[model samples]
Target: MKVLVGADIGGTKLALRTTTPDGTVRVDVEIPSTGWEAAPVDQAARWLLDRVRPVLPEDDEIAALGVGAQGCDTQEHCAHLAAAFEALGVSAAVVNDAALLVPAAGLTDGIGVIAGTGSIAVGACAEGTVLFAGGWGWVLGDEGSAPAIVREAAKAALAAHDKRRPDDGLLSELLAHYGVADAPALARAVNDTPTPATWGPAAPAVFRAAASGSASALAVIDDAATHLTALVSRLRARGAVGETVVAAGSVVLGQPLLAARLRERLGSAHPDLTLRLLDVPPVAGAVALARARYGLAGVA
Candidate 1:
């Protein structure tokens, strides 16, 4: 039998799904994306193939494959990955992982926002040219993402300390979370090793502080929401064709406050756009794209 394969490759993990043309799921599994690298296309292709080969049924052949990759920021990058896959004897379509959200929500055209370890917004114009905003990674941007929230929260807390302002609980929350006794130590803890693994885990402390009445934490969250909203607006300004915004990823999906704030801001800024949380795993979108692109079936 011929099978369609799809994969959603994020910074933390890769989710793979395989289904027959009729949408019967055959294999669904997730694995760490540890060795995966998007650049040097051949290496990316090999990394994907290594994982995929074991999960697929021995008797089945892959008719088409769709991939949503985290580091595939540009069309050229995606095309390079696709060519690499083709060279390795697999027919594949590759896109930025954020692009999976719209199709995962079962929409043909819309905007996708991901706020997990990192954040990015993706959409396409009338000509199907993909557009992007934000997604500068944790250090510089990725404003609604978990690591970014923690990064900003730390900065806020440190600023308050330097000014001799009263602790709004944000500083204490961060200090406790990082197991540091004072503000300077907290700065050292956060600044010494600035990675998603280190910073993302502390994001919940920011939200907790906010819930416990920390104005600084609330302001950080509000700013994050605003930045997320701006990503969609930027996409629209660049002629992205979509009336809906589909959001996914751990930060947005797991944090009700952030989700609510984003909804409120998006409503105020783009009243015409509708916000929807993706209920399905994003690999479903890759599967749908594979089916559609291969003339097997429309999105499911």
Candidate 2:
């Protein structure tokens, strides 16, 4: 069997797995990322190599290495990553984390929506026609991401405080979650960090509050779905993909309302376009792509 290693690196977490052709993580390690801007690519590569080395078989040569990282898609970034891998004593192919989602979804090509710390959407055709919408990161775009929802939820709370709206479940629960008993403290904390991924943990809180019939929180969830669907719609309209879209990432998979809203929105844009949920993890998708590349699967 061909030996391959797959790594999924993000801003906050890093996941590394060693597997054979069938996508089993015989040995896996999850670690904290040193931050996107803080750690250089070479440093990250070394860190991953350290974790993967122990799991590798002494007699097995690494046939190929596939990396799924948050910002590895761009040419400049990928070059640095490739150089980093070279420094770490591994020749590897690196790609955008979203690109790996295609095979992870068990589809050769389709639209992928990743709703995690931040949000982004990707569309691909069977022939390798890839397109992207959103994914501007937490600062610029990243609508429908967890941070986006938290940011909006915070805004709504402040607005209610200013307008003398009821200090109901939405505002009250938000303050408690953030460890602030008042609107001013919440505002200060939000402004202090102000990063999109920073608010990721709050995405669940938004869902919880919404589930309890909080109008404001529900509105936030609806808005997130609307934004995400808009991206999917644009990709479909541009002929970047076919009729089916696959939803990936924690927010899309973990939150039922977000998924329902995405389906609803997609139904309006392309009634024939079916929205499916990806049950497998992205690391599995990375192995799927690796299998395809090594001539182990049907792609050959």
Candidate 3:
């Protein structure tokens, strides 16, 4: 029997799964993606080998491996990863983690929109040139992402407090959520640790505030949806008019209201757009790529 593996390496999680030719998953492995984007190419490869080695059957050959990672945003990064894996005595394919969104949603071609720790959209233009938007990371631009939402929520809370409300609803909620005493303390805490992992989890505070009719929270959501929409709009402007636009990630998927608002907002531009929420984990896209690329049916 052959054992083929696929991986989705994100900012928070590194997931690996082995699948049969029939697409039956046999094994799944997950590990922390602590500093993966900063790690050297060889270090990342060794990280994968170290974890995946002990899980699958040693007798079966590695039919193929495909990895879609947050760090593999650049073509050079993708090629480096591909070389590193193939050097490990297996054929490999590597791509940006955002690229996995469309395929994971069961589309051979479409726009892939991801809004988790960060946000990015990938698609091909009319001339078949692959185009990208967002994915600028936390510091630069992760609009509509969790960290971005958290930052905005914090700002909203602080702004509300500055309006001399004494103690506003969102301000209180954020203060409690971050375990901070007040706005000043919250600002210090946020500025101190401005990482996706830290701020991403706090995004729920915004939704919670919105649920209770917080105008500031609702505005933040509206702005976030608009920012995310701009990614697709930019693609459309460039003539990347894909029929389907698949959305994944906790921000959009975890919040139904955000999804509805996005769909409503998009109706004007993409009237015939087929919006899909990714049902399967992004790692499955890598598995599919491995199976098709390597023709794993006979190998297994």
Candidate 4:
């Protein structure tokens, strides 16, 4: 059977799945990302390919392979990934993970918003055109992302610590979750050994505290919703969408309050907008793209 491979590389986890000839999608093979972005592109690719090699058919026709990755949009990034996979005896295509949400939502034309460890919004048109807003990485943009929210909340927690206040709310929850007794310990953790994935898991806790009426947590989540809504608004203002804003990724999906507020704020901004949460992973979109581009039927 002619088969295609689909790989989704997130900030924290890597997911691999394949489609059979009958259009059945196998469940994901989940693994840690393990600093792939910091290593040489080829080295990272080879490492990923090695992990995937065991599952691939020994003699099946490998028609195509598609990769959806975080922070990998440019040609140089694609080339490096391609070379690495090529060394592993597979021809692979790569695109930004954000863009993968487009086809995953099954919308040829609409806006896609993803709030993960980072955040980004993408717009697709019927003419096969794509546009993006936000997603400038955690430091500058990704306003509604887990990392961003955590960074902000951590600051608030530290401020409270500085004021000698009781660790009694969202900040307290975060500090405890990270196993830090105080703000200085948190700072040291950040400097010594911090994972971008570490901050992401606390996003839900922040939302829960906000839902229960923690002012500081509410403020942080409110800002996340506002910033995310602003991206959706920008896409709408540019006349880039019709209806249905696909909400994908970890942060927005995991935090119900953030997701609800985002939709509420967006509806207020544009009454006709519809929010669609993606049921499938981002790599499914890449598989669809490969099928469309290579004239294949489903992914292998």
Candidate 5:
């Protein structure tokens, strides 16, 4: 039997799905990405093949494989990875993880935005050229991502402290979340460990402070929405096609407030665009791509 395989490799985890040509699922599982790296095409292909091989029945062979990987930042990188898989005897298609949101939402051409631990917007032109914006990472950019939200909130809180302003619950939330007693320590704690794992986990406190009516927290969220919207606008200007923007990821999906804010902003800024939240896991997009590649079904 021939099988189609699809995988979504995010910063934290890899979700793999195996199915027949007619779309009957045979295997579905998620594994941590801890031991995996997206670079060095040969090694990455081997790492993925190692996981995929075990999931296949003895008689089953992979007819087509598709992958959306987090670190596939460029078309060349994606092509290289695909080539690596092909060299291993598996025909493959590869794209940036954010690109999965559109197909996962059942759209053919559109913008895909992710604002989880990090954030990025991806789209393709009419000629099938992929475009990307943001996703610099939690440190420099990724403004709408979880860690970026926390990073901005911390900066706002620290600035307020320096100005001798009263705490607005935002500062207190950060202090408590970081287990620091004062503003100086808070700065030290945040500055010393600049990573998504360190700051993203503390993002909930920003929303909590916002829920409690902290002006600073609300401002942080507002800025995040603006940044996210900007990502779409940038892609559009770069000749990205489609009017719909499919958004997913932990922060945007989990926080209704951020989602609402983003929706409102996107509507106001791009009246021609429609914002849709992805209901299916992004791995579905990989599967859709695989199906298309194997001439089994169409996605759009």
Candidate 6:
């Protein structure tokens, strides 16, 4: 059988899928995510190839390849990936990871909002012109992302400390999670090496605290939802209108407090805008795109 291969590289995992041109799924596998951001593109390519190699022998003839990798945003990076995958002898396209949300949500024309380790909003205009907002990474952007949530939670914890009414629960939660003695030490530890894997896990603690009625924690979650909502509005302003908005992210997916707050906020502010939670894993979008490479419908 002919196979279409697609891979989605995220901060925590690399998700891969294979399908027939008619969209019948064949292989689905997930592996750890690492080193996709190295300076040399060949290293990134090898990281992808090593995982997909396991499925190729069983796939018979390969038809096409599609990749929505974490750091393959620029044309230069995409070109590098193309060169690396040339041995596969199949047509391929490299795209940004956030693009995976579009097809994952089952929309050919809609904005895809991602708020996992990072935050980004992506959409294509009717003319097929792609437009995006945010996704500047942890430093300048990714406002509503998991890392940002943890960072804000820490700040809120310290702010309570400055007022001489420190909530022990919030502060202790962060310190224990990061394995630090105090808030100051926790701050140092995080700032020293603030990778997504380091800070993303702490996002759950913030939501848990908010669920327990922690005032500072609630505020942090509220702000996060607001920031994520802004990402959608930004897309609209940039002429990326679509039938619906599909949102996905670890922060939004598992956290009821954050998700509830985000829905309420979006519902109240943008009533006309249709909002749909991404029901499928973002990696499935990669599969859909891969099947499309052969001009066939997706089975994912």
Give each model's whole-structure lDDT.
Answer: 0.93, 0.74, 0.81, 0.74, 0.92, 0.78
What residue pairs are clashing in model 6?
Answer: 23-299
lDDT of 5 by residue, 80-160 (tens): 999999999999999999999998888889999999978999999999999999888887899989889998999999999
Give the Cα error of residue 33 in candidate 6, in Å: 1.6
Best by lDDT, which number?
Answer: 1
Residue 22 displacement in candidate 1 (angstroms): 1.1
Can you give the TM-score per candidate against the true fold? 0.97, 0.87, 0.92, 0.83, 0.96, 0.89
Using TM-score as the measure, the top candidate is: 1
lDDT of 4 by residue, 59-138 (tens): 65556677878767554676677777777777777766776786787767678888987788877545544556887877
**RMSD for each model, in Å, please?**
1.2, 2.9, 2.4, 3.3, 1.6, 2.5
Please provide, for model 6 over 80-134, each residue's C-alpha lDDT reduced to its tens digit, 9 standing for 90 to 100.
Answer: 7767767556567677788788787777888887788888887876777667778
Stretches of candidate 1 above 4 Å error? Answer: none
Cα lDDT of model 5 overall?
0.92
- Residue 151 displacement in candidate 2 (angstroms): 0.3
lDDT by residue (72-96, candidate 2, tens digit) is: 6464675677678776666676666
lDDT of 4: 0.74
Where does candidate 4 stray beyond 4 Å?
38-48, 74-93, 125-127, 160-168, 237-239, 297-300
Compared with the true structure, model 2 gives a TM-score of 0.87
For model 4, what is the alpha-carbon lDDT of residue 213? Answer: 71
Look at candidate 2 and tell me the lDDT of residue 292: 53
RMSD of 5: 1.6
Off by over 4 Å in 6: 38-43, 74-88, 179-181, 298-300
